[model samples]
Target: MKPNASSVSVVRSVTRSAIRDVTRHLRGVGLRAAPLALALTFAASGGLRSAHAQSAQTAPAGQPSKAARDEAATRFKKGIDLFKETDYAAALVEFRRAYELAPTWQVLYNIGQVQFQLQDYAGALPTLERYLSEGGRQVPAARRTEVEADIQTLKGRIAFLDVTVNVADADIAVDDTTVGTSPLSKPVTVNAGRRRVAVSREGYTPQSRVVEVASGDTVKASFDLVERGANAASTAGSSGDTGSGDSSVPQTGTGSTSGGSGDSGSNVPWIGWGVTGGLAAGAVVFGVLALGASSDLQDLRGTRGVAASDLQDASSKATTMSVVCDALTGAALIAGGISLYFTLRTPPSDSAASAPRTRPSQATRAPRATWSSASRPQSSGPELQIGISPRGAQVIGSF
Candidate 1:
């Protein structure tokens, strides 16, 4: 049933009395200069009716209907009651709901008041700024000055973060609260202290960084996220050189066995033998060259017409080749002994039986996305490397 003129007048009168009482209570609590007072003052003086009437006439196509506006008014009154009861948190929630139901600028003022009362300076700063921007000339000059001063105070207690991300549509969060998605339109204001900012996307590895900022400072943070598949591919490529030739092969123990048997791994017996064989071949080639040089020297010495310089040259060549051949022969013997030792070493029977078997498919596989650095097992046992040049043969390894 539609309310009669007398009931409407009584309701308005009761609302004005409640506003006056709340204003008095705020003064007693040292919140005399609060935006709450300004909000209640305007609301008591028919400001809400004027704004609502104006909004209804020029309401946009998607604007809330009359029922939504009525609901918003109910929620706004509930918020004021909660605020009077000192339940600022509950008040903030109701005010926020009212703003969502009917996006009038006045609710923003109430929201900022509740936020400030709750000591949510970071949240209040933006809310009040938005109130002023939306309210425009509708907001009285005195009230604007008061809200502006409150904003300055809020700025003194909070900080700003200009977060940037390489990918679009990535979610950005500050201290676990989702602020916006990448390409964030503006800087995110937060309480002054250590804050953890995280960025995540569907196809990329999530990234997070902790940063500290003082109040009123503006800090810039950048994130370059890597695609999940690409990161895994890069890791696999880097570990490829260090990976075992056949993942199916069972690894042997590298420690010494107690019973005259070697627990030490063979250290790739075939490779050691191959290097020894190559050194031996090199020795034979140098020996042949030395022999040829010596034969040339003999021929030059036997011929009377041979130049002395030629004989000297032949002798020098033979000496150099002989030295190289001897060096190569020595290297071959050392390499052969090392290869024999490696081949003779056998893992303990217990170790061989206890060795874990890994399938080829399981060896190179990794998580598509991860927050930690990639890790790979190191190959055990002494590594033997051998190199041969025209100068001589060189062997590097631990016995």
Candidate 2:
């Protein structure tokens, strides 16, 4: 049924107003449920959209959606619950996940708190310190103070002891408890103050020294343990030899003895050869001179019959040759004596000081006396006039 123009227009206007009112009501409802609804929508979109939204929320303040913020808060609360239960191992995983999701100051604080509970002070220290450095303004004042105090306490408790031992690989004990073998590569920690340290090694004397360690301070103590038998022997050996006045000088090896007289009856063959060589050279020279003199005397005897002048001259020349020959023969005998003396001498078995008779002065006296006689010979004399002088013995003769 076709309506009139006014009625149709009024009806159309009512319908449009009603539609506008309905649309406004739906907008209100969407605003009220936006975060949860968007989260549900994100979940329906294969979880990638939700991750992107969450990442965006973890960005600086202007970037995050309400839904992403709520999700981060939920994860952070879950980590807190785990931490409260003292499940630090599991709590660390949860806190790390939340930190990745949001990167908020509170999440980082939770991570440090869990690490501290787990006795991971080294890890916790850096994390808390970083949070204070980067996101300090976001952390509550009370919590910041607490974390700072915790850091100080941990620092105090972390002590170091620089232990040095004189001997390597010796067993070390601290406060009567065996710690390790030296030399230690790094310092170890114990409750600060006086500690009893003992070092020991096989075949070495055990040594101990007391060391005092201060809180947060590294103390070094070095120990020198003496060898077991060394001290006693050193003390006893050094007592007699004090490096004082008039100590006898020490000598070394086989030739250190001193003696004047040596044994002289052995190795006759070599001595005889030396003597024979000297005597033979002397005999040859003297024989040559005697032959020349005999020839001259014979010529004179042949030419003139035994004049006193010629006879006297011939005798004098013969005597001089004879004396020279005798001197050579004596020298041969003395050399033989010296060679024999050294050969027959028995080497002293004891040290020179202990063998009083085996001294140098006694060894050389006989050889020197024998050599003096070989160097000089007496001339024949008949006048019987002799002069004894301080310089030497002399004889004057008229033949």
Candidate 3:
């Protein structure tokens, strides 16, 4: 009545298949009964000639591979040893390895503690911030206090910038070296003294000013650059009025001249007046453009489900236009003020002397038109076409 070897083999195969199906079903149900099912099946099979029992005995259920477990244990041991020896730096390396193997808040806390002990307050600030930001109720109050104090101390020594440049994209130079672009909002530190500040942008005259910085105090200074036309006027006035006979003839040297006084007076009057009128026009254009950009930005903010590409394009164009208009407008105003000041102080020429000069007026008007054109809002089609390319967006002249 004993079964033959082939018959017994067939029965064992059927049992193994049934066990696999049940294991899969349990797993689908989120149950952890595969190991127990395999154990019972093997025990019923006389604890021999069963592959599942042999595998289970060799590698226990739910346990990681031997190599991984060994590596983790080694890292944990090294971390504990370093912590005992008070070698925080070495400990941090080992602890970090353990954290990578298995992430836990305890490991992060240890890292933060070591960073604090090493006086790397800047590095510790972010880690502590992350811990706080996680919103875990387990973070201790004392640890929070320590991290906060460290951050506050670092902030005191850190130099920040609250830069306000009249021109956007204008390079802000501190002590003759460029630091950042204008319209920066933070406090930046320089050697506490009368530091030379310069703001420079293409198509506009460079403006320089002196800022006296005190220790632990933020210095505020802004560049009020003169537009090209206004700058030309100021240069002409300052250089052309020298008492020397050739001064009114725009001498190449730095000497004063008085001989061409009549000619200089005649040329200066209209050029100055044209520069003033152009600048005022530019101001009006800039104001209009600013209001339009603000309205567009507000509209974009309220809109939903707009294509990402369109939103990005609108935002970038609005920002660029806003900056360019404001900068140009500011430069024009500065130039206008300087021109007005000089016009009032200088003596007027007689009508007979003024009648001959007419070319300077025409020359000054071209730059004014260029400035006004730059301040005007761009046509949508051409501007969008240009904005698609890198060079187009960087066109500072037409910005």
Whose lDDT is greatest here?
1
> TM-score for each prediction?
0.55, 0.26, 0.26
Q: Provide the overall lDDT of each model, using Cα atoms, as 2-decimal numbers.
A: 0.75, 0.59, 0.55
Model 1's lDDT to the true fold? 0.75
Candidate 1: regions farther than 4 A off = 1-4, 37-63, 238-240, 244-399
lDDT of 1 at 254: 25
lDDT (Cα, tens digit) per residue for candidate 2, span 1-399: 234567546545644553354345436533222212222222223133334445433545654454655566555545545544546598588667755655555456556755666766545777778877876576558667877887787676545667788888899888788878899987766556677888899878898888887768888878787887897888866875654321454333223223322223334547676776878698779967977776777777777567889877987787788777766766565555444444443343455436433344554544321224453224332222334455443434344
Candidate 3 worst ten-residue window by lDDT? 381-390
Model 3, runs deviating above 4 Å: 1-143, 159-162, 173-181, 185-198, 205-216, 237-399
List candidate 2 segments past 4 Å from native.
1-75, 159-399
Q: Rank candidates, lDDT, best first.
A: 1, 2, 3
Poorest stretch of ten by lDDT in candidate 1? 368-377
**Whole-model lDDT for model 2 versus the true structure?**
0.59
lDDT of 2 at 321: 80
